[model samples]
Target: MLLPPCLPQQCGKDFRNSLKQPSPNYPYGYKTKKPRIVPAFTIQSMQKNTIVQPPPKCNIYEPQPARPTMFRKSYKRGEFPVTIEFTLSGKRLSWKVPIEKLDFHHYLPMFFDGLAEGNYPYSFIVEEGINDLVKKGSYKVLACVPQIVIPIKRALETKRPAVICHALKCIQMIVTGCDKVGEALVPYYRQILPTLNLFKDRNRNIGAGIDHTSSRGENVADLIEDTLQILERYGGPDAFINIKYMIPTYESCVLN
Candidate 1:
């Protein structure tokens, strides 16, 4: 097969030429390409990624951070009492047992414990149950004040706008829920007012922009101040003193 003699210079020249030529890719070989010329603007853009990292997480677009609460555990365990009916108007909560028969010592704190939940049927049932209990339970709500403080504190401590709004509303309900509920709440001000104080100035200045949450009553700062006013109004003689002690920034709406 090697009968023909070849020149060394010619063989070397052929090998170098082969190295310069484009290698076979698929069906056929192609020409070698010059170095790519990227646009100067694109090069600058690639060097400095000018797009924002992302919006700060503190805003409301993010879902409320959930905390495990006793009521949530009970609901998951199917130990929650009351029957719910979803009707044309809205959801209706009915007691499986008579409202009068339900022990405040047992059920009141249990319903209050659900305040941390911001989602679904749990929020509805908890809010409705508390409302009904506050309306019907009479002096029982006042009696359960000591037991329910921790749940109230826990709900507000989450610093979630929605949960805090719900808890503040519940506090307002509890304060005006009946006679002496506020007075009863006075002693436990230390436990409850810290979160209130923390969120007391939650009133955001959107600068002439209409706050839809205000109309929806979902604003936490306003709710806190309103809750404080309700407390000051009904929390009896010592209520203001205790609230003032816990929340230094709170002013009396009742007096000058």
Candidate 2:
């Protein structure tokens, strides 16, 4: 808009000075404005923009149950505890042993005592115990043979034909059951042979009333025959020759 002229020269100078000075809207130096206050994000506003993710699924592999290797079936026979099973010469045999009547440790000693005391019924019990051990395996039979052999050999030396025959039968079972056992008894053949001669002609029912027979289905005499055969088989042909040579020496040792 048009304005009036300055009245004086000083007034015109003052007006030029004012025009040179910066206006309030357009200041010479840049003046920073106070910072604008921005309100913080609330939980509801954040939830609207948030990206929800589901948990990862795991793939766990579980194994199946294992099968048993031994005794598949339970003992169905009477109230027989401790079913004994073992393999011999590729044949597997199982027997149910009554624990009350047959204790393995005292079996051989008690058998010998039965013979010593002339208790025929007790001898049958002992025979049953031996049969139980035989059914267990050759290993069990062989383990007890060393202990059994001593008493059985002593029994052979006795005057009673029954005791001698019973002892021979027991020896026969042990020796024939396993080849290893037969080989073990080979050294004792010389000692056994001389005793066997005493019983050669003595024919009597040594195992009377003993219903439990040998595993080979033989009586005492037959058992002695089988045992001698076993010893001959394992002792080799040289064993017979050795026995011939051993006889004179054994005779001399006895005579002296």
Candidate 3:
């Protein structure tokens, strides 16, 4: 009980007909879609399921409380035997006992602690005292290096651009004092480097295209680069590697 063979004209038509879908049998192989039944819910019911989100918290960099420096406390308490005299050069600390004869472990680190003070006299004394120490501290600086690091770390943690910039300058001062000073700082890279890395790309918000304030230490990014370069130069071979470990983004200043 076979049907008649398809002729050339009928073959095309029959083949096309065979290719047609045999589903819900809608035209163009489309199925007959069921009517959409949206859930029956009142506006109140819809509102019940809706979520109420709170406003986002502000993430702006608010100024932190200025940490009290032990140096300032001690100086005010008359512990330091230095008299502050205001000269044309600003402020100078004249030690009752010469700075060189003083205990490096105690007073050197004490002055370093004063670097956190943004106020006058204290700030001036810290800078002048540090310059004097760096110039005359001699081998005592290397010994006092470990003690000085804490103050440096504290200053950096303040996250104030000016304080951080000042701390970076202080870092360069100690690093330039001795070749071993840089290498000695290698172990403390973990402590000192985190803030540097945080501010590594940070530049001052200057609108002027030609930067008139292109001075060093003023720019955190430049200071960071220069500081690292100094570390690499004086830190021996292990310097760059340790610095790289702390700051993954740092490119070698010595290497091309």
Candidate 4:
């Protein structure tokens, strides 16, 4: 008997021989066999081959440069050095100070306070810087004197004699250094004269042996004398007459 082509040769021979001697259950040809079960290893092998792979990882960390601050940009405006020259103790002195280093606007109040308190070293440096600026005849420096005069006058009213004296010294330096600056201060004379009057009778020797001979010294008499000289120079010869009229008796005695 011929077997079907779909079956294996050996299996076909066995099936053909069984067909010839059919059992009562399969009388016509042959009974249908049950389906074969697949192995677990075959299913695992198919799953492994069908899996999708992941893509390559990217680099997350990389260094970056730092950004500059606001102050760093503002500082660029004051980068230039300003060379200032003035006389201190009858000797010529000069300093090339960076514009940023001279924070005058912020420290001017403290400077006045220190001057009034007989802080000579600090006062001298400040006064000399002003004198140097004036001597340079800088329009920018001269323009600022008008605004500064009133504060200096206010400083004259401090209860501390040393402070009053130093304020006077600063005024003297301002007036003596430039005519325009002196003229600018003329209007404040009324406010200044009264303060100077308080120190007229003060004859104490405050700075005696300091090597520096400056109006910033603690010597009360020198301060009064220098202030009077500055007033006369800028306020004209009749400047004392104004002071005299303000306080007749005291001015008369001082003048005499």
Candidate 5:
């Protein structure tokens, strides 16, 4: 609406200056602290807008369980001669049934052969009436081997010597039921000696003489008596003869 038209020049100047000043509605200034589209320092995590599908999580392939190891057969009843092959090296060794399979008992010859040639898997057999053969003085054993430290542990671990000896003896005993010391004791003595020899020299109880008097309650005579009794049980005439020939003269000053 139209009103009074005339105004002073100074009044017009003041009015223009008032217009230039900011409006009272926005006294603190138009640029107040606004909600930022891209925040300076964000609290909430950014939405993963790039659609980052992770390189598909790898399906970890677990290996299957290993199968149990199977071992070769020990021996068969009907199979007279058995050839055993070594697992690691594939070396072959054999044992044969003798013609005198019913009575033969000397393992020393076979043992010596195997030891000399390094031929393993030697079979041990004890046939019935072997004691009769021994009694007849037919079982003659000539040992060519000089003393050496036999590897008992190695043989045992590899299922040799002792195991083989035991298995063979078991088989023979099963077949023939021959219980002869001449055959049965030889393997035990031979296999055990190298280790036992270590103890023999260090003999504490059984001293220089068979009839030695001791301050300690135990006596060699008693021990001898006990051993003799045991020998009577396990040793036959052949064994008694062998023991008489082979065992060191405890009555004499025979060191080990």
Candidate 6:
């Protein structure tokens, strides 16, 4: 029953042949399963279901302070009052006050533009205790306009150039009293009547060449009368006379 060595060689070829033949249990070799794929529509639906919320506003309910209301009840620069007014319920307010030793040329327009726009809750430091209210702060309901400016360009243009210049000189003397001469400012008023009358006489002498034509004579008179009205309001001949004396001898022609 024992096989020979040649018989074992034959057995090895048969074993190799069995491996090459397909078996019923695994007919198509080892099978590989495919992975399941997610759909694009499902991903988009998830994104659509998500929600986001924004931050709340800081000041929505506060009411504005009443307008033209007096504040602190003290005079500024020794002449003007400090007053304030509100607009937009509780949203904004404005302040009217004067500055001392401060030129309007530098501060006015900047102060005015801010008022025209709603940029309050701000501040400007004038003195140690006083802040102009438009300073550094967060958005809030109680917005304050710490400054107000009145425009006077029209008033300036309507006045005669010479009269305007003269008024400034007179007002300076009346306000400051810087110059003291013999009879000081007194002789200045006495001088005014003569100078104005002189102007009239010169107009008559010039006749047709005078500023007033025959047809416009009444109108010219009205203009002069209006000027006189303003003069009376602004301290009259007394102030004018004082200003005349204050003029240096070298600049005397300006008074005329």
- lDDT (0 to 1) per candidate: 0.79, 0.49, 0.78, 0.53, 0.33, 0.31
Which parts of model 1 have CA positions greater than 4 angstroms off?
Answer: 1-65
**Which candidate wins on TM-score?**
3
lDDT tens string, model 4, 1-256? 4433455555766766765564555447655555444344455435533433334455222112223322223324543233234555563335565433455443333333334333434446556555565555444445566556556665565546555665776777666765665656555667767756655665645665643434447766567766665665576555657656654544333346
Candidate No. with top lDDT = 1
Q: Per-prediction TM-score, please?
A: 0.73, 0.44, 0.74, 0.46, 0.20, 0.17
Per-residue CA lDDT of model 2 for 154-204, tens digit only, reads: 556554545555666566666666556666666666666676654443344
What does the lDDT read for residue 240 in candidate 4?
59
Error of 2 at 148 (Å): 2.2
Which regions of candidate 5 are displaced past 4 Å? 1-82, 85-108, 115-195, 200-232, 236-256
Candidate 1: tens digits of C-alpha lDDT, residues 74-183:
87887766779879997799777778788889888988889989898889989999999888877777678889999898887777888888888888887876888888
| Model 3: CA > 4 A from native | 1-62, 88-91, 205-208
* Cα error of candidate 2 at position 178, Å: 2.6
For candidate 6, lDDT tens digit of each residue in 1-256? 2233355557877766665555556658545454344344455335533333334566422323322212111122322223344456743223343344334333432333222111123211121112232131111101211122121121122233332223222223222322121123243344333323322222234544655443443332333333333333344346444443433221222245
Each prediction's RMSD to truth: 11.8, 34.1, 12.7, 31.6, 27.5, 30.2
The C-alpha local distance difference test score for the whole of candidate 5 amounts to 0.33
Q: Which stretches of candidate 2 lie over 4 Å from their true place?
A: 1-117, 202-223, 236-238, 242-256
Question: Distance (Å) between predicted and true CA of 25, model 2?
Answer: 99
Give stretches of model 6 more than 4 Å off. Answer: 1-99, 102-187, 201-224, 233-256
The residue-by-residue lDDT of candidate 5 on 1-256, one tens digit each, is 2223345655876766655555556657435343334432344325432232335555332222322111112123333343444567654443454433432333322232222111233322222222222333333311211221142222222322233233233222222323453235543343532322222232355455563333442333333333333433454444444444444432221211
TM-score of 3: 0.74
Q: Rank candidates by lDDT, best first.
A: 1, 3, 4, 2, 5, 6
